[model samples]
Target: MSFSTQVKNELCRAAMHRPCCIRAEAYGALLHATIFSHREIRLNTENAEIARRLQLLLRRAFSVDCAPRQAGSKIQLVLEHAEQLGHIFDALGYDLKNHVTYHINRNVLEEDCCIAAFLRGVFLMAGTVAGPDKKSHLELKTARHSLAGEETSLLLDLHLSPKMTRRGSTYVLYFKDGASIEDFLTSIGAPRAAMELMEAKVEKTLRNTINRQVNCETANMVKAADASARQVAAIQRVLRTHGEAFFPERLRETVRLRLAYPTDSLAELAARFDPPISKPGLSHRLKKITELSAAEEE
Candidate 1:
């Protein structure tokens, strides 16, 4: 299953025996579902776990039994009966006959646990999270603009800064950063999914570090090889134009070492001297040889 599905399944198993928490969760689910109003209450989901959870929440919160039906790959839990809808609205503290527009009822979410349950319900209805291997994105989509705005406020009240945008006909409340997504998943009772996101972040960071180190080492080797080749060429030029006997003793010794080990790096060549020289000292001798060879060519 996808990571999002796993998160929802984990949330579905959260214990909900408190009456206030149950009502809060059911209120959130109905508000974010496919259709929720005075006349009709419909919830649709492709996830079996979410469909099952919604049905259970409705029954447990209001003592109403409503079963979900499978249509192709999607499962839908629909409540169309006026009396049943009225009962649900009554339990959620909404006046079904008078209420036209839906806004989050903050009074229902007085406690932290109630808020968490409400958010859990919202996720089960319309939430999605990208796998950490891809990108850190968690969004709740709704067609009702007012409900979206209210949900954004609710998230802000909980100290989460969610970005809002419109996608086609839907309003989206989303979190992009990994830390925010992790906290969101944990808040909604999906600790395991949050932990997985953290692990993915650590793995990605480690891989990037290793790649940079390897690239640095490869570049150093290339630079060292290029310098050795140039020094060898300069030494060869001196040997051809001016015989070895014409050079000073130290210059002759440097030329002999360069010609003998054309592939050795400056540090490696320096180590071969009777009393080892520093890399900078060996580089100075090579520079003199190159200058003299250039003068001869000119």
Candidate 2:
């Protein structure tokens, strides 16, 4: 399934309680997530107005600000208003903090339908050709590590003038025939090994994103739990700060576990029990004793 579709399904599952609110929120959130995941904002031929359209769409969707710039011939897009964008994607179940945009490109050789199909949609613009024309003279060549250079060489070989285009602010190869030099790779028998390596790189990038997102979620949970524990600890610390007063045997054991292994989780502390205690049992016992001690003081 497409990432967007999977996200929609997940959102629907999560919103069984309030379908209407989820529908509205999920639409906006999905849009934000997809846009943020895009490595670059590209436009060609009829898509020349894409930058302007996206900026306006973002303004409407997010009610957040955006800025555009031109450095020489290249147009730059900056997301000046990230707060709402961040919030929206977060709500959509994407860990935006762990998501990062990275560049991925590969020269195509030998018309793989999968690749050809991917690029056809990728390069499609407002008025561009619906798909590749079989009669086009351009052919793709296999050249690894130098997408721009390989493209430049291929165009030079074909006696086509290099028409430069920007993938966002970065310059990439384009040709007068309304297709990128990358469009020619498959026609020239580019190496399969090179293409496989490119695929590997992209796979690694996706895996890293998955791992980072999981880690971020785990870290956030730990931080929240720790904050609650620290608040209770702070009160106890104040009570016991001045001098070591004798706590009841049970309370002493609880206090000892809390002190000796300050960073250990409640479960780990419980496991240290001569007869292992359940986390809830340890917690309840500690709470009751603390209350009793507070009552004695009062």
What C-alpha lDDT do the candidate models reach, one value each? Answer: 0.86, 0.42
Q: Which ten residues in a row have the lowest lDDT in candidate 2?
A: 124-133
**Weakest ten-residue segment in model 1 by summed lDDT:** 97-106
Which regions in candidate 2 have their CA more than 4 angstroms from the true location? 1-172, 175-187, 191-194, 214-218, 221-225, 228-232, 238-251, 283-298
Instruction: Give each model a TM-score.
Output: 0.83, 0.33
lDDT of 2 by residue, 175-228 (tens): 434233323332222223224334555676799999999999899769846844
Error of 2 at 186 (Å): 4.3
Residue range 141-204, candidate 1, lDDT tens digits: 9998998888888788778999999999999999999998998889878999999999999999
Clashing pairs in 1: none
